[model samples]
Target chain A: MKIKREYMELGALATLALVLLVAFPLLLGGFYLNLAGKYLSFAFVAIGIVLTWGYGGILSLGQGIFFGLGGYALAMFLKIEASGSNLPDFMIWSGIKVMPAWWAPFSNIYITLAAIVLIPATMAFVFSYLVFKKRVSGVYFAIVTLALALTFTVLLVGQQSYTGGENGITNFTTFLGYDIYSHASTYAIYYTEIVLLLFVAMGSTAVIRSRLGNVVIAIRDREDRVRFSGYNTAAIKAFIFMLGALFASIGGAFFTIQAGLISPTVVGVTSSIEMVVYAAVGGRLSVPGAVLGALVVGFLQFYLSNNFPHIWLFFLGALFILVVTAMPNGLMGLLDRFALSRE
Target chain B: MELMQGQQGVIFDGANVPAARRGHCELSIRNLSVSFDGFKAVDDLSLHIAQDELRVIIGPNGAGKTTLLDMICGKTRPMAGQIFLNDLNLTNLSDFNIVRAGVGRKFQNPSVYEDLSVAENLEISIPRGRGALASLFFRRTKVVKEEIRDMARIVFLDDLLDRRAGHLSHGQKQWLEIGMLLMQAPKLLLLDEPVAGMSPREREQTAELLKVLSVGRSVVVIEHDMDFVRSIAHTVTVLHQGRLLVEGSADEVQADPRVIDVYLGH
Candidate 1:
């Protein structure tokens, strides 16, 4: 690998990472490919935190709100597309006469995809503007956003007729008249998912390397100084929040396409917090750290549960605690420190 | 558009302040008071910083000097007072807004992000100073480059632009903070202990830099180093118990009997 000397000698590691990213999805068996796809989506959420929370110093736990909202938006579209003549699987059980008016716009694939991007971006724009403009920061900021995620999930669960209540919009989605249940179709979905995942990673990396990326870091370290320098911080933060939300939504939409299902639990508060853990484990500033965090956590969740089903969660908690206290910088930070010590 | 940034180039005199009226919008503080609960950290303070004026504030530990700077920078809101920056009202604005109103501040501790490169720190503060966005498309505009170059030249940081701010010397870090303030290009620059932990040589250089930069903008510096205060300060303001003890030329204030007895406590 061609290494840049100044990356703390990390350029080789980054190149090796790129090679593995492209190769892993291809070489892994069908089961692992699906697993990796899920990991990629978690990374999407991590990137969101990296931008708004990590770089801009806005600790937004409410990212899951956008993540799930994007999931639901796309899920609503797939259900409508699949319904064709018969009512969606959940709607028949819920005893609804006809589809709701809100579901009508999603009937067009173009509009649904547009809504997927536009709606979430717009919401982030408004929400972030309000919070940052008020200068609600630190512990209070975290609590408020966490509350937003909780309140949003509760709303999804409460809207029985529209949102399918706690069950969420699931048992729907077919990619252009093809049944997604077959193994071949899943493989196809897997490759497509990989492509999207790569794009998301590359896109985020590009942004982080750009000039505006500097502002995000500046905002994180010194807001007073930055503001005095003449930047509209609230506006910068809101813009980044919206961008992060759009990425998560795209990830969520990909997630739905793969599973042929959508539900509240996947995008719930617990899941939102899980994204935080993944980012933390991978280390916040390291883009690759997020992927590593998601992959390791996901692998552990899958493997440990299978062998030690009863004590698995306890093990996971113990692992997380160890990681948090001992390796606050996460796996990447540890690796970096170890590498530094050697050099 | 390109040259507007150069208009404020390297000078310390606040007279360059673009004003609605004939005189520039130099900083004016009247009866400013800040309290932590009821402690009155800064009480009934009034001061003014003129254009291109390098004014040094000195007091013993816990004398409310830092609090005075904090209030002016909009980091802390005073219970009662009016702050006019070039005649623009600043009483109701938040920290960011006040920063936008044309005031720059350097923290006592190095606030630059260690994880980021020096160039990255420069890039981040510049867009804000130039009123640009942190979007993907925001390249370094011509004005941004000129401003960054000008700041780098003053701090002798031109060669270390690509290096991380974290790896800098104590002196370099102080210069980086000042560079950040220059990116802010505020009419009044508020510095908190610019050379608290530097070597004697570094402190002397900082003293010289302050005197050099004070030609076109208003600057308020807080210092414990008596010599530094004497060297750079055109006017001296002594703060004690969050209030002003006396204000005049550095020598006059130093010789004042009241300033020594109550404010300096020497």
Candidate 2:
């Protein structure tokens, strides 16, 4: 029987999920598992990049803003909960007696969860409307998003007391009344991240196969054709961009939970560009390729930082250039060509 | 070609749009003008298309043939003028809204999505639940499948529906684009240079397709191919220096002395 390409993709995703969710946890010890969890969280952002930059053709250079927002929202809530009516440690250290008015809503876990999804999506919606509605696209859109990331990083760094003064929010103890530092909690968080990643992968695949995804691709290729076909191209672009932001925000929220910290470094311009590199290295157009890209890049960064230390950045830069120049479609395209090769 | 079941009812939602008079003039453009810097691309051009009319526009390279279609489809905003489809004004509406208001345009170059298959291209163009949410949850129902199949057959692409549009020949891409436009079931179809890169056999097929397409709809075609226009044109409109020189049947327009001096003679 002839197998459809989409089915083959689904099979590959299932196998990957089985390995990551089942085999990795059973085989790897605590340290490696935790590291893998961190890498998997990056996969969320990579998947988002595929949707926005890869599919919708809206290259957002500042996905870190959404990720940071989601991470901070959860971190702020946890910090407040750990304070037990006292000010968060950073506020007290900075000599502020009162918690800011904005931080009050994050005290409720429900609200923080909602904010994790809504905040980034809202930012995306606003930015996309302002720019895409005006018919701005290509490099102009990229520059605007990059500027946004830079400005936001500066703002977070400048607001030292509230944002942990560049050191970022750290020292987590409890989450949802469970001890997050314990081995069981670490395992739970790892499993949770894996499950969420799989869910996002499947959901994104469904979307990419849907009419929405088709139209988004069409708009990416030929915007005027899509617009003349009676589609609100701006709205479609905005929606996909917003979805990308939502995925990144979710990833950010998990990053804080897994790493026990939310820092300005993660939301910086360098980090945003790094996230794009992950997508580009994976296969911008392939969701699974994006996930693998994040995993590979994350693992390489970990290994390189410990082994080569100073040379890691240069290595990454070379990798990016090579991927762009030599393999424009990234690792997935390479794998696809191999799969289609019949000698 | 017959429309799919349940498609005709929603073709024009009278509640949100003005009712279209079947036998009357379908598209009315009044005093339309758009200038780039001080250069007039289109200057005070007025045109009318009765229901089911196939109007062919022939002109020189810079005679504003494309700008005319661009203005009608809202790709380029006109400096002064009103475009009315049926009784609804379409001048200030955005590109997508103008399309939803019953005008589908095909660009000079075949603009179908290269990455998508021919069927998928037609599916996206079908105006079923066009909102972001609607498209997200869109399912291929029986009507949608039949509509796609019927459109594919109409465009001579039924056997190649699963082929990627990028893999198609130049003529096939043109047919695919026309198929996509027909999927919308648009009342006014604006085509710009549809046969620029087509073979002679393909041009004959397109002419036949356009004849059937204009049965229940109005078509405006801009082309440089005089032989193709002669075979397909119901009325030929000559444009020269951003203005209409003459409007008559194909033979009559060919015989006009001013048309010969300005356009055909050169």
Candidate 3:
């Protein structure tokens, strides 16, 4: 009976995929479709938050660091390709006569793709492993990650010559010589992002259902007990944290593609906290709920900011407060309660 | 004194004699000492546990009984001591490594994963697939399921396998924890007040369970209930103020002047 409930949840995910794959493209126009793509990109981060925060019980307040790393990785490649044999325009403007050795690696598409995933994953693993090894967790771990976000943003903004400085890496028009702004390419990217998001969600679900997932949950609850059970609780947490970073990095790469830029603004302390809000509002424990949360919250932010620009931040704060205090389980919890009542 | 298999199948009458003469010791602690703020919690404690022996430790409050177990399980690093499981030095090993080295410890409180199902609680304790990646891909085979079921039966939780651990009664939770330890198949088990909250009926069952569990391994239990100690203990070791006062049968310890002075008299 319990297993059936799990399968039913998977069925809900399949239904969600069908709606994203079919319904959204049919109903929404080009601009709305693009906006939807952007929100879906954020869903990557939300899914990651679900895994790390919801399941593994590691609340990372610096996911923006990984997101920025991924965005910058892909943006660097695009900027180099667009520059075509000259230093990227920012470097030239900053009086850099030669391409930095680090920038050279981004020029290769394969290396850029690999870097987008690997860099954030390695950083997350090493950082979390060291911290968890020393038994630093709970709010302390969160503070460390928050500081990481702040530090990353400062470094990005300070590196004017190599990283494009406060303006960030932008004005890239093509990916591998194809026109990215063209209507067909936009639709193509949107479809690719949707498919990848669904795949990631499925993978996350499989992991949550696995034995490792059980151990992660156990560690979250009674870490000492799990340790006494002969499991390396630190390594388990690090692995999940790394997976979360991997997902966020992929999302950042997609955001760079869909939004056409990467900036410190999108990869700072505020943005990282906002990423967690997406998970919290969506239902941290539910993978599909995370995607829905990103979309709903993303759309609300867009709509509210357009209409009442100055009040949007306050509105977001209120919503977060409401969710945490009144509905701690988020939208998924509500849906679950509703379903249970109906049954 | 000669070693004999009692009605319980394994019982040591005089384990205080040096362990080298009677086969091999399963756990050896030598001159273990630890102090906090100039106050010794466990001081100069040297003890040996033999194979297939169920030893009960009876002590008053602040007697360092739990602290001694903590040192054995690597939860507490002794200022000076050596702990050995056979020939393996366990004093410096981390908690998880010490657990892997064949020592299972149950805390004073029931510490089962309350949110997990009884089956999941047992399954997570299986010694295989301990690595992060290994566990990610670990499968529940038929053999594993059967093993879980058999263990549940032993702990008298077979019917509650699918129930959430939080919903279980106190005695059930304690049994689930012991079941978890049995899943590790540790050579030495350290249990602190295993029946602290159990009813008299549950206490009787736990005593039986401990006797059955000690057949192939060494079991050390700390208890205040003298009746429970007499029921399951092969030999009794008494600790008072971070030191061993006496080691003997329950009847002998009950008659000892030192044991009566520090503990039983109260």
Candidate 4:
């Protein structure tokens, strides 16, 4: 039987992911595990970018808005839980007596979780519907999304009483009755994040390999042709974009729980563009590549910002330019070339 | 159904289509006019195409041949017009909705997905799981696979199904695009300069394929190749300055003095 190259490559990737997931926890401890957990959560957003921008051909530069929205939602729930029906410290500091109506539903964990996914999905639906209905796409769509992120950041920063301002929602002591600060809880979060990341990566691979994936890519290549071939182009784009938003939201939720904070800084234009860079460096079209890109970039940022804080920004800018020029397909493309040459 | 009943030419309601009028008017346009800025691209154009008819549209460069197709396919909405595709009023519909109403369109350029394989390209146009939820868990059954193979066979790409569409020769890419359209099983196929870049041999094959395709559907071919048009066209519609100059058999159109003066004269 002739083995398709795609199947072989997928098999190799799955094996690699399995090995990494099982071995990483054993090799790393304490601070490293916590850091890896955070990175894994960030991978959710990167994988989402792969599905939307890479596959669907919808480049959203404001994904930080969705990520921030999700993280903030979960953070609110966690905050209220920590507060035990009382007003959060920031709200009290801002001289607010009553809990905001929006913050009331989040006191229930299930509602908060739903909002974490629904908020971004709803926002995506409204935003995508309006934009795509008018047939606005390409760079215009990117600019709109970027503007949204910027606007959202400003709004979050300005609303000190409701949003806790630039400091964001923080100082959470518990998550679902577990003492999040305890070593056992941190390990649980790390393991859960790793498992979720692996599943998400696998799920995305399945999606990209499905029949819908072909149509999505076709829309990316020749949208008019796909439309004339009887597929609703805008609806398809909206669906994929919404799915991407949901993934980012889920990642945000995970980040809030693991890191014990959700801040406006992560939802701003800078971090939003950084998410795309992760996808670009990993291999925008490859699911596993997106995950690897997130981990590598996340780790590098942590290390470089610590050791050479002043040079980190310059290094990142240079690296982005180099990757875009020299390796447009990213680390996966490089690895693919090496593999093909070896073969 | 309402649009089909009130048209000038023979019209068939989709549900009650008579056996004798199987080739009834599939597409009917009335008083269609469109302008881009100050220039009138398609001015007061009206045309009726019957089912199973292979109608060829020939025009000079700025004669609005592409714009006509664009309007029909809902890529460009007419400033004033009514377009009916049997039971559907296609004038106000979006491009995809118009397509769903059984109007398939091919552009002047071969526009297959370059990054995908020939089989994948064909698979995308197979009208299943069109909704978001259904597409999420779309599974390819054996029947769908066989159908894709059949479409590939029709386009002469059965052997090249695994090859990337971008790697195909220009003629092959054109055929792949036509195959993609065919996979949707549309009632009407609007081809805009399909054989524009094809070799004579490929053109001949395309003509033969299009003739076979017209057995169960309507086909509108917009081409500059008079020889190719004469070979397959049952009727020829000549357009000069976005207005219909004449409509007749191939020889009649070729011999028309008005056609020569306006289009062939150039």
List the TM values for chain B, per candidate: 0.86, 0.92, 0.91, 0.90
Better of 3 and 4 by lDDT: 3
Q: How far in Å is the alpha carbon of A265 misplaced in model 3?
A: 0.3
Candidate ordering by TM-score (highest first): 3, 2, 4, 1
lDDT of 2 by residue, A1-343 (tens): 0134576678769888988988998999988888888888889999999999999888988999998998899999889888887999889988998889999999999999999988889988887977898999999999999999999999998899999969899987899789888899889999888888899999999999899999999999988778888988888999999989999999999999888898989988899999999999999988888889998999999988999997888999999999999988899878776776742
Q: What are the models' TM-scores? A: 0.84, 0.95, 0.96, 0.93
Better of 1 and 3 by lDDT: 3
Candidate numbers, best DockQ first, in rank order: 2, 3, 4, 1
Answer with 2 or 4, whichever has the higher lDDT.
Answer: 2
Evaluation by DockQ, superior candidate among 1 and 4: 4
A best-first ranking of the candidates according to their lDDT comes to 3, 2, 4, 1
| DockQ for candidate 2, C-alpha atoms | 0.84
Model 1 chain A weakest 10-residue run by lDDT: A1-10
Runs of candidate 3 with Cα error greater than 4 angstroms are: B1-25
For candidate 1, write residues B7-119 as lDDT tens digits: 43524332344433223547889998778878988888888788767888887777788887887877778899889887688888877778777778888986776767665
What is the RMSD, in Å, between candidate 3 and the native fold over all Cα?
4.2
State the C-alpha lDDT per candidate. 0.74, 0.87, 0.90, 0.84
Per-residue lDDT value at A22 in model 3: 97
Model 1 residue runs over 4 Å out of place are A1-32, A52-62, A138-140, A182-188, A222-225, A325-343, B1-25, B31-46, B59-64, B127-136, B140-150, B156-163, B239-245
Measured with C-alpha atoms, the lDDT of residue A22 in candidate 2 is 87
lDDT tens digits, residue span A102-155, model 1: 877887788888988899999988987898888777778778878988898888
TM-score of model number 3? 0.96
Residue A122 CA displacement from its true place in model 3, Å: 0.8
